[model samples]
Target: MLKWQWRQGIVTLFFVAVGLLLAILVGYSQPAFRSADSGSLSARSGVKIEYPVAEIKTGLPLPSDRTEVQMAAACLPPQRTPTALSFQAKLVTPEPSRAVPKYKPQQRQEKVHPTNYGNRMQRDVHHRRVNNELLVVLHETVGDAHGAISTFQTPHYDDDNQVSYHAVISRNGTVIYLVPANKRAYGAGNSEFIGINGVEAVQTNPSLASSVNNFAYHISLETPVDGLLDDHPEHSGYTQKQYQSLAWLIARTGVATSRITTHAAIDREGARQDPRSFSFPKLLSYLNQYPRPTEIPPCPLPPQG
Candidate 1:
């Protein structure tokens, strides 16, 4: 009986030892926990806190330190704007396009010159085949319209010394008809042309003198009073009236705005500097609004001798 009692006590001691070992092992395996506020132990105990993906990205409850927050923000991408949120929004609200301005055409009297005033012939007179009546050459008449008309009208005693243009615009914007619309007007002498259609080798080669008079329609603006009076005249700018009449004349020529150019631009001699201070932008703006003929009128038949 004594031996059996002793065996039961030994077995009880062994069981307690095994239980202590297991408790120690369980404590070691579990992570340690501490409460930030001892009063809210229940709130912290055995509860896991996890931040959401959105919170992680946005950094919700941002840091109080401005410098720290700025540093953190620097690492993040810029916030998208309403326009950036979707490309379609940008397309829906596109920037405005450039617009041309409006203008009224100026009316003027025609003091027509006689057929003798202008030389007879087509564009190809001196290999002057300026076909298509395409180019609108800008020139500044060194003298007034009256003088220009007289010069054109007078059958030059020496025809070789004669020069003429199609139309002349006075300082007051009066458009004077000098030469017939489609006739060669000797407007741009020693001029060269490289039209949009391709190189006119025969017309513009350096070796051969390029004269646009064949294909070009010349419009001369009367020099400003000061422009002509000043011996060493500079570009005395044109008046508003001049611009209006010039624009109208260009529209009449039945040519594209691209076809309009300056004598200085096409001149090979470089001595020609007419139509000073041309308002190209203003002219182009008005051209958009003005109506034009589909084609240049054919030259009137030379008056029967």
Candidate 2:
């Protein structure tokens, strides 16, 4: 009878130990993982593994803490870089654009100052082609527009070749640029400009003469070969467009209307009479819009001599 009681007591102790261990594990939040079939706890690894009690009961192996940490990190979003963000913005944004102004023939390369075009830009500069502008001389090319422009394209010096006009107007009235406003044009030769009322000098320039080349802005008008010389000219005189362009150009300079004269009027030696078949009435009709003195102021006499 005593031998049987000892076996029974040892069996009770074994069951009691197992029951306590299960209670401890089930009550704790931090799961104590065990091998699929091995009921053993791992050493402290500082990583928690989540395994459902059902999974442990079934036979699925509990993943290691290191593997759990690596898998969790892989699921997080990637960090952004400045360069990548900028590229993305560029793809979504548009570039800025500008509108261009309309083209005008008068403004094409018409420099307000000299030195804008070099002497050799077309050809070398010759003789005096630089002087103070006082008169706006008018002329006729006696040639086609193309021929006149081509002529100025080649710079010259002597009276044989030294020639240029500040501007040229085609039969269609397109004002073509030739020289800067501040430069001299070979418009007048042996020509003289005596200001209205016998005022021959410009400011301190007492030596001023009819040779107005020193102070003139020469503007030429193209002539059709057939219309170069006509007796009592009619349709070939000048176009309305030409008159408009001329007046506009004259106004731009702000020069006095009376100061505006013709190549024929200023020509000296009586050998020149150009800008033929022209109508002063037509030119004045358009030029009248500019500011001009109503009357010429009298010239002061030299203290009654």
After superposition, the stretches of candidate 1 with alpha carbons farther than 4 Å from their true spots are 1-130, 157-159, 199-210, 229-233, 291-305
Over 50-110, each residue of candidate 1 has an lDDT whose tens digit, in order, gives 2111112232333232233232322333221111111110112112234423443444434
User: C-alpha displacement of 69 in model 1, angstroms?
Assistant: 59
Cα lDDT for residue 285, model 2?
Answer: 82
Error of 2 at 161 (Å): 2.1
Maximum-lDDT candidate = 1
lDDT of 2 by residue, 1-305 (tens): 89999999999999999999998888994756543223565523543433311122222232343343233322222311111111210112111133311223343443222222212111112332222325678988876766766667654543445567888888777887777555556567567665422332121123323345545677888875666544333335777778777876765554556678888887766655567778888887876655442323332222221
Model 1 C-alpha RMSD vs. true structure (Å) is 28.2
lDDT (Cα) of model 1: 0.55
- Clash totals, every prediction: 7, 5
TM-score of each: 0.53, 0.50
Off by over 4 Å in 2: 1-133, 157-159, 197-210, 229-235, 292-305
